[model samples]
Target: MSEEHNSRTAAPASAPEKVSLWQKFRRWPLIARIATFGCGGFLALFILAVVGGACLAIMDPEGTEERAQQAEDDRAEQEEQEEADRQAEEEAEREADEQRQAEAEREAEEEREREEAEAEAERLEGMAEVPGVEGMPADEARDALEDLGFSVDFETDTEGGVWDASNWVAVSTDPDSGELIEDDSDVVVNVTRPEDEEAEEEDDEELAQEEAEEEQSDFTITQEGGDGWSETTVEFDIADNFTMNMIRNGARRDTLEAIEEALEEHPDSTRIVIEGSFPMTDQYGNTEDSVILRVFYDRETVDQINFDNVMVRDTIWEIRDGGMIHPELQE
Candidate 1:
């Protein structure tokens, strides 16, 4: 066993063979070998470039710093470009939003104007201008208003005694012509009779005046006293059965004549009190005499009043019971 061991030792013992990377690469498939070689080549080039760059930096410090500065500047420039792009996008979006808002407002204004125009058009549809009727005859004015689908109302002017529309002339209209009104509106025609025509009935008026004078002689002074004539009050009695012409004249005319006679009789009287009454039957046929007229007129108020023309009740100082028969008097 010693001789065998000496023989094994005499022959050089062979070390185990190590496999090289080149040989291992040679044993790989064609595609894997190409991929491995390409990867290894790139890695070797990268290592060489790194070692060479280190050597260059050590040899040329200024060039190394210039290259680093250039890289930093490129990075900063890229960031600035990105920021500019982002800001431009934001500004474009804001402008678009503003434009949309402006368009919406314009549309809303256009709609409102259209609605208003339509409303105005509707308002002016069936309206007509009121025609001039003043200074025209009452009947002619009424016909003209009726022709245009308008109802006519006649109002008598002060000093107007004639009730016939054909005999009167229109003084004015309520709407006063040339005003826009509905076609179906009411038009008031104020009319009056000419004074020259009233004078034409002088004979009849003179006869009536003679009769009034005859009637005034019957008005007896019932009572007369007040502060020793400084402010004298005169009360007169009027006939109850007195009538002024059957249908042509009013009963108030006799009462007015009685008042005038009292004033003439008591010129210095401050107040003239005249009262007259007629028998009134109620629904139950109970007949009783109630004071239907009372007149309290001061001398100053009577001076301003026109006794010949019908005195307006409101124009008088104080009047009660069956007020004035004038057209302008309210109830």
Candidate 2:
């Protein structure tokens, strides 16, 4: 009975207690409780918002598209500001990195400068004494270098020495020639010497005397005790430069090797030059082949060596000052 009375006492939809949200409010307030028609809960508002936006994009439905466009413009503006901020931070970071690199480079440069200065100071402070000859005679230089307590050898243009005439003997020295050497240590200095002109002059003279002596008819280069005669005849032309006395004396020799050794030993000797080869018949009909050579040397060099072929005036074989003798040619 009570339940039937309560159901009959309910208010109608038009009553103030059951008023629709639109009828209750002239405008919605943020703090006010909302009222709505009980159609499909509040889900119809969200669906309407989406459908209205889609319609507006196509046909400007209900001015919903205008509101969405405003929202998109605001979002784009915020993204642009964020991107700009990121770019500014990156630029600042790049500048800081450059500053750090520049500072490191500066420190390295200062360190190099300091090291160079130290090397310069060390070079200036050294001053020491060195002994022994300083120049280019290999044997002499070696001796000198050794005396200075240094164990060093040389490297030349060749294993021997340079051959150029105009070039001076230039050598590189270690520990510098005048530089201060370490206490009790060795000092090395490189020295070079010129070619010996005197030795060459002597060679020319000795060769000249030998040639001149060989050409004299009175001279013979035979030893005693040959079956009647066993001797060689070296006939050479006198170069236009020989004196009569030089020609006579050049026939004698300090040493006489076999025909084979003579030619092999002095392949370049003009005194041994041959015009032609032929056999000469002795009065007894014995045949002998004589060799010929040219004399082109000076007599001065021969005198220096106290050397000359033996000179023979008599037919008997004998050794004399730049002369020879042959018993077979006795008058």
Candidate 3:
């Protein structure tokens, strides 16, 4: 009995200890336990998701959005540069083509002009080169040819117009001295008067005529033209040892008038040669007075020198049609 009483007294003390310690937990709620378990599960899931996301970010694809954007920008810049270069090249090519075209046009124009000039020259030369045309008087022919851009060399035995003997001339074209000229070249003419007869009777007759006619006189100058050649001749009287200045103005005037008439009749197409003779008087004593008989024509240069180096005659030169003429006195 005593033991049972002691046990009962100890039991009360233990009960208070148990109630205080378990009081809050027992208040409990089934709802609190369920909520705790749910919260714990949710925290575990959230931690797992965060770790997985970090791993996925580190192992991203080879072509990232940032890298793709950078590549696109680089490509665009390259394209822009290439386009600029291509445009510049095109512009340069176009300019070069234009320049070439202009040059070609200019060359063509020059060639055309050159050909025309050559043709004109050829026409005139052909007319001058005809043989057997020597019979034509040179003075009248020269005037006709000069209208066509020919340069003339003339010498007359008589004071151009009416005289005892007829005048004669030798004609040539440019490049008279050396190599032949092209077929188309202008005629150069040379004319000279016939020598006065050397016979004593002739001299006396001339003196008597001179005494009778106080003033110098001349016959008319005449001209004739054919296919390409023209003839001019004048009849005149002249004294021996007379200078050009000494020749009476009336005689010269008559010859000039006739020559002018011939030129008026003939235009640029034909070649003319003036033929005549003149007695040269060297009052200066620097030269000898002699008869200078020649054909006056356009060209005057000579390759070979003959007969007293007289510009009037005794030398031969080239003329129109690239022909050569060696002057010889009429038989």
Put down candidate 2 lDDT per residue, 46-154, tens digits, no spaces: 8998888677677855465667788888999899999999999999999999999999999999999999999877864543445434445555555565665567545
In terms of lDDT, model 2 sits at 0.47
- Candidate number with the higher lDDT (1 or 3): 1
Instruction: Estimate the TM-score for candidate 3.
Output: 0.21
lDDT tens digits, residue span 18-55, model 1: 99988987999999988988999999999999999999
**By TM-score, is 1 or 2 better?**
1
Show where candidate 1 strays beyond 4 Å: 1-36, 129-173, 176-179, 187-331
Best by TM-score: 1
* Candidate ordering by TM-score (highest first): 1, 2, 3
Q: Which candidate is the best by lDDT?
A: 1
TM-score of each model, paired residue for residue: 0.38, 0.26, 0.21
Error of 1 at 69 (Å): 3.1
Error of 1 at 118 (Å): 2.2
